[model samples]
Target: MHVLWRGDTLQRLRLVSGLILFTFAATHFINHSLGLISVDWMHEMQKWRWVVTRSWPGTIVLLAALLTHASLGLYKLAGRATLRLPRWELVQILLGISIPFLLLPHIINTRIAHVFFNVNDIYVYELAKLWPASAIIQSLLLVIVWVHGCMGIHFWMRLYPAYRRIFPLLLTLAVIIPLSALGGFAVAGSNVAAAIEIPSVFANLKVLTRWPDAAASESLAWLRNLARIEFGAVLAVIFGCIAWTYFARVAGPKVTVAYTSGPTVRVPQGPTLLEISRMSRVPHASVCGGRARCSTCRVRIERGSYGLPPPVFPEVVTLGSIGAPPNVRLACQIRPEHYLIVTRLLKSETAGPEDIAIEEADSAGVEKTLAVMFVDLRDFTRLSEKRLPFDVVYVLNEFFGVVGAAITEHGGWIDKFLGDGLLAVFGQRDGVEAGCRQALRTARDVDLALDHINAKLEAELGRPLAVGIGIDAGPLLVGRIGYGESVDFTVIGNPVNVASRLESLTKERDVQLIMSRGVVRMTGWIPPAALTDQVSVRGVAEPVGIIMVKRGRELPADVLALRAEEKEKEKPAAWTAGFWGRR
Candidate 1:
């Protein structure tokens, strides 16, 4: 039952129905193009239309499915009254509303013509004769129907993982198929006009009777008949069930959690802290949708630590990998059976409540400086394509885990993961000097961690991995962005970009670690004896002193062993340390 109600199932149904309709429309257009081949071919195709339309149970199912799909879409639009919808969705809604109206005349002129008039020979000749002057409107209607159907298919395909992987290919096909069919139709239309002989009187009459009014009236009559049937009642019932289920299942209940002071938040039961935070307008950043896949939502159970259940398999693995403290847990996986206060360590807009709470907390303040460290993988593009997709993801996750551990171990907070890099901000939440020192220490630790990781990779895959680290110190503006239902708390400033750029220059300088001059002046922490100099970076207009960070002899025996493995390989193991120096 749960499987049946799964969102993916409904999404699949929508996709399949859309594909069926798209195929039918494409084939129908190609058939219409038969006029280019010969009038006899077009007439023969018209004869088969009655046979196809009345085939055992196909017509009934086709009508039922189309009506059901349309109603479901309408219900979704009606439900989002309170939330702000994207502009693309609004355009899609408008297109959907126009489809039935534009399609009515075409449907009646052909289907009703055969049913009522028994005019089995109503092919492209009849259509061209009746509406020769309205070709532009007919063409526009065809394009609109095709575009709308394609949009529906695209929307449904986005829900599937496999489909997403091949989205570009699918998009290419969607474009090509329609254009090819249109080309075929244009050729057919030209041929039909050239071959058919039209009397002067008939040509004059065609222009006079080209208006869509009569066809529209016939369509309205068919719609009136449909509205009075048991089929309509069945459709209404099914639509109501789908709407109720979507609202109940997809939207769920609105839950809100409020944070007063400190890191703790009081939330209702049932929802995990991450869910409550997100749904309640709290600013929390969860890059991986609170699936315990990433530690972006880690929080400290400061007050009610005992009330929460122990971490599950995924939560336990992720927590252990990052070396989280006993009191710390992933907010996404922790579903407290009772109300509890949990201190959110990562201050994101989605995790924190209101701006007032943050302001008040600052007013009743604690100020400290912390170190900020940035580590970026070198030659990521080359590495990405060198391995399988899964391998690339695994290597990145492992790299981030090691880097994150080094930061936390040095008493620094990880601001965010910048794609193939790590951004760790040390001081503002703690203290200036402390932050600078921690940043240096983290850089040293990262050098050591990478040595270990690379040694393991070399032993496993016969190759080495390289990364660059940059440390900087400065003030930053941190706050939540978004309102009501969506919010994300993030740090922004020049220092962040400077730190990133410094990391970028590491590969060119043959250095693994670099620190800004501001860091050196502020912290008074010198690099290990083996490290080297100051170099000028672009944009700064002045030389910044940097160090060539290396694994120190004092590193743990296990770490030293890993370094020894690299040393034995006799590969180029030099790194430059400076503000900006080209090797």
Candidate 2:
């Protein structure tokens, strides 16, 4: 049997199933908490059970879905070549194993008993006995199962840009939900115990008072039988869906396509080239599934660009940001409208550190470039340590927001955030003069923001904050770099490094902003008072000229006068020394 291994599709299935299971488990926990209110509330849950199970078709569908999900999970586990999995994977496996064991007995005791023995007193008798003794076990199963499923969903959602911001919030909710459910369960258990002691009170409950007589009515019996049949049909439909998807994958048409480097043969009409590549035994990287959220699967259309559809929205956004060639596309987003030839740019199955780092090096080798800016936060480590985790996060967000806004406003793109620093490139999208002016304007804006941030923090935390910035202009290499699974577009070479180093010197020089002579010469917009001679840097053999910038909406007249007076005093001292020597 030719088993089609649609890894991407299978991953997506796992994501969907995991999300469904998580949502269901969350609701189940909340329902269990209702037990805290009173046994009647718990007993009321049976009504919904009937609704969920009333359609035989729905029950059958759920049963099949559960079975297929479990089977696929097992298949994935067994197919793994390496025993060394990630810590999260191990956690998932352990939880997966425990769930069925804990849940199976509960399912058999309730659903199976009702189906075969006509025993419907699940809420009153069975749950009371099992829950008290196995409360810890049940809670454990609930936590593990829900967490496992939630983690899977979180992993999948990380692949999309829109969902990235919500990832942490979703994870936080996952933890909060289980705790709330457990609290409710405790309350319900106590209520159930109390009600059990008062038989008179319990007998008056609606479910018991309206108990169905076994031989009472043919209509009631017919309804019960119909409900069971409907439940079975539900299960059947779910099974059919899984079966159809599997058959479709296996029976799909196969095609051979030539890659720039080689050839791969696989089922045609896949949602992505990565899917086809994986099935064909061609090595490919999909760090974030095939969502086109990450550029790990970037490939150039060598000879068959016309055979593919125009780039999708995601592909266009990601590729455009990274300045990819018009023919370049993400393998995960490209579906073959026709036979095609492609060349993978990044040549590794896993993302490596060199992917981003090497790209910077490559960009620095370019001939003519625009502007580069380096921003370093002042005393970030000290500030971070003084604050709580949440506070630190808030502060960093604020800092990044301000700097990012400035960069983007001036038509520049951020290369990367280096801990407490920021590196940005200008001119690749526009022209050289525009890039230079943008960098300068961004520096001035940053100074303005720092004043505002410091004022706010001073009021809130009784402290001030500062940052130092540097701008430089030069020719450098700029391009994307990475092997198969990881890649980024960044600037590289000495100019980029020097810009960073210049920012570092600002603290000792007492300058809020500094620009290299290269920038002043290229832009020809240097202020006369701001210009300074070559200053010694740590590494380079020669000194580099710079322009020191002071904060303030405009340079203070008094501060300028003080500088002039100091220069005058120095000249008088030199003259007096010369006169004394002559005498």
Candidate 3:
């Protein structure tokens, strides 16, 4: 005997079954729209409907889908960590569960009526059965069922890039189909009512009254009662399951889950961290609503994970697919039985629908504004030419250590090291303003750090070492560049090219640090109006304005005053976002 409880399999089964049900619902809605032409046209469409839904093959598939979708839904419901979800998700769940109850009466009157009582429920007979109360009930079911299916399709398709493009057109179709069906049905009802009042005009009136015999009418009545009783029983069971789950949780041990986001939540042992977050009203990222289909709710276990429950098959699959580290786990799946400390990987405060789109775009390669900085070790080759190879390596190591600390302290990421220098970038995590600000700060820090390094290494080097730096901030193509194994994540464009060229310009211009005009504008920085000059960059079409820092880290008293004024004018607290918004 073989049984599979894999999370991916279960998820795929749920999707397939739900889609099957949606297909049937779509066909029924389309058939209802045929009433716009004539009630006769609707009746004509019923022949195909019967062949599709009433035939043995169609009946098997429809019933299988209903049973499979419903059972899996309830199974998922019982195992859920928390009932609290986003509004749309909650509404979709309620509508999905309500489908069977709403469809019970209508199904009993039509297909069940046809099978047991041998009654043909055409538009006339169906129209009579749906006059006052039943009509409103059916109308509610139509909207609920249609909207439920559409929502499922939406959540499924939203992850796809192309889906966003055609969504408005799809939304228009979804609106038009249902509204047209209601209008057509209302118009058909008026015509049927007018005919009913005057029987002399229509000779054959079999469609008006479906109850040909007392036995058939009695059987139909019995089926209606049975359907209602079944609906009541289902409601009782669902509510009962919910109550049992609540009490079962109440009896379980309590667990404390600590977050890096400054909150510690205590919940019953049964629920996951996501459930705890929702129950405690803490904002946590779970874009897939804790289905384990997304890594948004991933957290690193900081402490007390030894006593926590191991990942189940579904959770294991999700974590494995994302190439998650052993220390990291999805908060939606981990049900801690003891105290646990966890740090959420994604920002809960800023993560939203927009973030999801941005993440997708990044994976597909997109342009972003970044601050690029190039560092060149000046006079190193001339000094190293006189030293031993071992002494040269030692000096290079000292220089790298000094500048590396400075770069990291100012929030710069070293992309790669050139033989004698390194290229660093800022704003991979933060936005333009912060990145630009950090780059300028690093230039100052590196100059100071090198002074300390040179003083300590007076024996290894005859004189003090100096480095030339060039920085520029602007929009660039940031993505994975290269093929397969040789691929590298890099930011490339005019900004990067100009910055590299400016580093070379540093020695020619006899300046310790230089920057393109764009960096100053981006940081809202006002450098002193000193001997600012223009230099033609190699790849650029025109000459670019340059900010020359002649005295290294030492700015004149006037330049310092202007910097203070710029800081007062544009405080970072007052201006957080630059172009794409601070990440």
Candidate 4:
């Protein structure tokens, strides 16, 4: 018999079952919330709820989902190769384990009793029988089940953009639904207790419910004890799996893994490369917790490729989906069989939620022709040295605000801010020529914005702040890079380095802006027919050809006309005053 234990198939099964279980829990909680109105209302809702839940089809599906979710959850736990888990994952596991123990007693008391002993397990009957004594246990079950379900939903949905957009509303409902249910449960229980104090209400309930006889009551008590013992046995088996896993680690033969990033580990032969990295305290990316969902944990096998086993179907599909090269394999899926040398293809710290959208190979990190711009504040440091720190911060914020707006306005993203400057990239979506044009336009707009800001802050400043702008365009590896929380989507290549050098060279050349011949060629823009010089830039083998602008105000007549057209567009229309005045 062929067993379907593929990681992707198991993940899908886990998700579908979890959703079904969560839906049932949510509906049950809503039904309990009706108890806040009256005990009769709670009974009314229970009848409607049971119409579906107690039906044969509904019962079959619910049981299947419950069993699947529980078994798969435990299987995942047992299959874990490393115990070094994130805090949230640890919390989720603990909560999930606690759920079955808390849940079994409630299920037996209701569903089992209703089927075997003809007990009417409605809200009214349950509240009358067990409310005052078993209230705390029931309440704990209510809370634990709902929270476990929510965490499961959160873990999967957090990978999606739509879920994140409405997360606030979802969070509000998560809190309010459980609180309402708990309140209703408390109020209804008290009402039932109060009503039972009178002889008529208490006597009426006794007749309505099929109060088990002495023998039946004894059988029910025996069943509950049996359930407790069985559940304890299950716990023992689970714990035994954990113990065996640890023991096997010591008993098994070890394989040597030499990571190109410096760590060399000798781990048991059974674990995957990602687990080996974790065991050795070497950082490796696994954005989806080694589920083979995200391709972040991919690594290149530099050596021992010939000896390595071929990838399984699921791993092949995942790797193929991302257009990964032949040498690359998912570190989370491939278990090294012998001594191997590998390098993590993606930065461990730079992986984030944005990785979900990175389907194309270029976004994962490939050489692409794009524009890079570097802008820096000139002489503002010495100017700020004489002012209060707060004052300097205020000015910097204003400076960044205008410069940042100009960059984005022309189709670029701010990569990072150096102390007195910022790096920006263009042409991620648009083509190379378009990116180059956008970068040039942004440079012109930055000069215009600085003039406006300097005029605004002229009273406080002894002189206007000057800025140096540099533009370069070429093939660069653009992608998300960094470590942990400091990760960013940016570019890294010769173009980035050259742009920074040109920005620095502006200070020496006493020019406001500098663009390499490559940028000028891409944009097809002609500079004034004057003395053009080639300057040797650091890190480049040969001198780079360039163009320079002494002052932004000295830009070509056609380019300066853009600022005039912008001003003309900004002027309010004659009828605008009446619109606001009427409002």
Candidate that scores best on lDDT: 4
- What is the C-alpha lDDT profile of model 4 across 1-583, one tens digit per residue? 1112234778889988989999999988888898889878878878888999899999999999999998998888877777776566788888898887767777877888889889878788888766789889889988988888898787666655577669989999999999999999899999899999999988888778876778977887787778778867887887788779878877988889998768788888888888889878898877667777667788878888887789887788767766677888899888888899987766665455543443224236667788999999998889998899999999999999898777767666677789889988777645677777667777877888888999999789888988998888888886555533333456788889889988998998989888898887776677765625688878889899888987655666554333432443222222211211111
Summarize candidate 2's per-residue lDDT along 36-123 as a digit string, tens digits. Answer: 5665776688578557744796577567666667767766554332223345556877677556766665665556555654555445
TM-score of each prediction? 0.41, 0.47, 0.64, 0.69
Off by over 4 Å in 3: 1-7, 200-203, 207-215, 308-322, 360-583
| RMSD after Cα superposition, model 1 | 18.8
Number of residue pairs clashing in candidate 4, backbone atoms closer than 3 angstroms, sequence gap of 3 or more or interchain: 1
Clashing pairs in 4: 349-484
Each candidate's lDDT (Cα)? 0.57, 0.63, 0.73, 0.78
- For 145-259, candidate 3 gives per-residue lDDT tens digits of 9899999888766645477669889999999989887777777766776776676634355544444477777876787778778867876787778778878887877888887
Task: Report the Cα lDDT for candidate 4.
Answer: 0.78
lDDT of 1 by residue, 1-583 (tens): 1111123334446545656667667666656666556656766775676476557576776676676667666554443322222344556666766666656556656555545644432555445543445566667777887778877665444333355558879788767666654554566556545544567744653454342346655665676456445444654665576456445644544333334333344433555676666545566655433435455577666556667778776677666645566887888777665545565554453221112222212111322233457788877767677678887888888888787776666555566667788777765423566567666666776777878888767665456777888777776665434432233344566667677777877777777777776776665544454555666666667677666543322323332232232243222212101100111
How many steric overlaps are in each model, in order?
30, 32, 0, 1
Worst 10 residues of 3 by lDDT: 574-583
